[model samples]
Target: MKLIVTCLFSVIMVYSTIAQNVAISDDGTYTADNSAMLDVKSTSKGLLIPRLNSFEKDNIPLPAHGLLIYQTDGEEGFYYNNGTPSAPEWITFTDESNALWRKDPNKNVTYLSGNSDSIGIGTDSPSARLSTDGMIEAMSDGYKFPDGSVQATAVFPANFSGYESAADRRWVIAMCADEIPGSWEYQGFEECSKVIDLEWGIYVPYEPGGGGVTGNRVHKPITVIKNIDKATVRYIQELVEGQGINEIEFHFFWINPDTQQKQVYYVITIGDVKVIDFNHDVTHVGNEIFSHVDIISFAYEIIHWNWLPDGIEFQDNAIGP
Candidate 1:
């Protein structure tokens, strides 16, 4: 009993002596730095801070100001709460500045300045009253301008004519189509045909001859005539009759230049008449046809009656300005 009491008394004295400063080091004799509450010194090791994910770090209850922790996810770095416990503002110690925008308690809104300064959302530098690198969406509210004018949801004009000054509407459509991939391909092109269909429009770039030692090739658009039908199936039938071949099997792939969608074409020439017949029944099969003539007819109806085409998947409905 006496030995037990003596050991407890010794432990208390050692703790009391080290209460002012605590030093952890390889060598037991090293003293702690006077400024730091707990000093850890090592030559071959590093001081590891508490690591937590964004969810765990944010859920810390009443975290004190100046509390530091290493976050593992969502802009991972060391974070310290600069604000008080009741209104903690945890900011990254890694490259975070005092002028950095502060997210509100709801976390939905972020504010860089309270007043007397320009505000920026997606950009750090602001050249105007409000500058953003991304789109600004106003949900269930109208926008008010500096001129004291309020604007609600804008609707397109009833008689709106697009690009009144432009000479060609197709050129404008092509320009708009260039911004997005898979807008359209050559019309009446087969989805599985191996040959390149010239009907779909293929732009081949070539260098023009000029008065120079070496000709530098420059790309330029060339006008092409769509006259493949003039090749005359009658001429092909005459040649086939001379050879006495009753049936000639031929398949061609066609791509819609406007939609970039491929359509399959299978043709069989019989006798000297060169009569055309589709493998699938015209009326038996569904509206979706892989034949060239059928697709052209379908496109005509789509443009004439403003009907929707099949196999079109929609994404975010945004038009470029």
Candidate 2:
């Protein structure tokens, strides 16, 4: 009885060891446990395999469509297509009209679009998917200006007095006296002492009365002196005949005292008469004559005769005297 019991006990121990080395599911099929299995092949009864976690080719069951499964607790789950599983946290589906679907924080989706096959993470287009390093690639294409051009206008400061007519009032002068050599000298005069007279006057407009005496002064024609750095004369010459510049004219006007009639005279100052080809050019000449007349002194005077009443007042009506 002792010998039979010893043999039975030995056999029981061996069976127990084998049972500990293998794993059995509820289906009655066995698989290798955590140990004692390496490079074993599958059989009809079971698979003599390594541990399920250690086996490189183990068939992992994928989750159903639209379903998610997790490998470890607290980790995001992945989706499955057919029997094949994807990386953890893979996208399954997203709402088409939702902007949050396009701006997902985790960035799990691969392709993105408004369709069902697309999974948006940060953008509505498929090209906006995140790179491998979890960085969102910029998909903004450069844009051009709408009309392909830029426009600007030249502006001058308000304090600039170069174009103001009121600032030119100081140029008007009646007469300037200058001392000259004198032929005869006093008793104590030095040798070669002489005296002469020099006078300069500016042209000014005056109304002629019935007595021939001018009255009711109107416009003043004064010589404008400009000290334009080193290129003063050269600059003035260029402006006189440059592109788009036609003939320049100096205008003189006289108004009658009694009838207030006015008469105007024009003299060609620079450029040719043929240069006035267009009406626009003529208008430009008018502007230039009003603004840019500088240098060169002119002389004029008025002769008066008492033919009308001294205190008479007249209303302006006539076109010319």
C-alpha root-mean-square deviation, each candidate: 23.3, 28.8
Which digits, one per residue and each the tens of the lDDT, describe model 2 over residues 1-321?
Answer: 999988875552123225456433333334556567432333434542222221222244543444333222233233223333453223423423534245555876543545345444544555323312122223563222364222211111223332211321211111111121112222222111111111223233544574453644342222333221222343344445543223222322222322223333212132221111111112225332223222433222221112132433233211113
**TM-score of each model, paired residue for residue:** 0.27, 0.15
Q: Judged by TM-score, which candidate is best?
A: 1
- For residues 143-206, could you state the per-residue lDDT of candidate 1 as single tens digits? 4447322221122112322111222111101100111122123232211111111122123344
Give me the candidate number with maximum lDDT: 1
lDDT of 1 at 221: 16
Q: Which ranges in model 1 have alpha carbons more than 4 Å from their true place?
A: 1-19, 97-321
The lDDT, on a scale of 0 to 1, for candidate 1 is 0.40
Q: Give the Cα lDDT of each candidate.
A: 0.40, 0.29
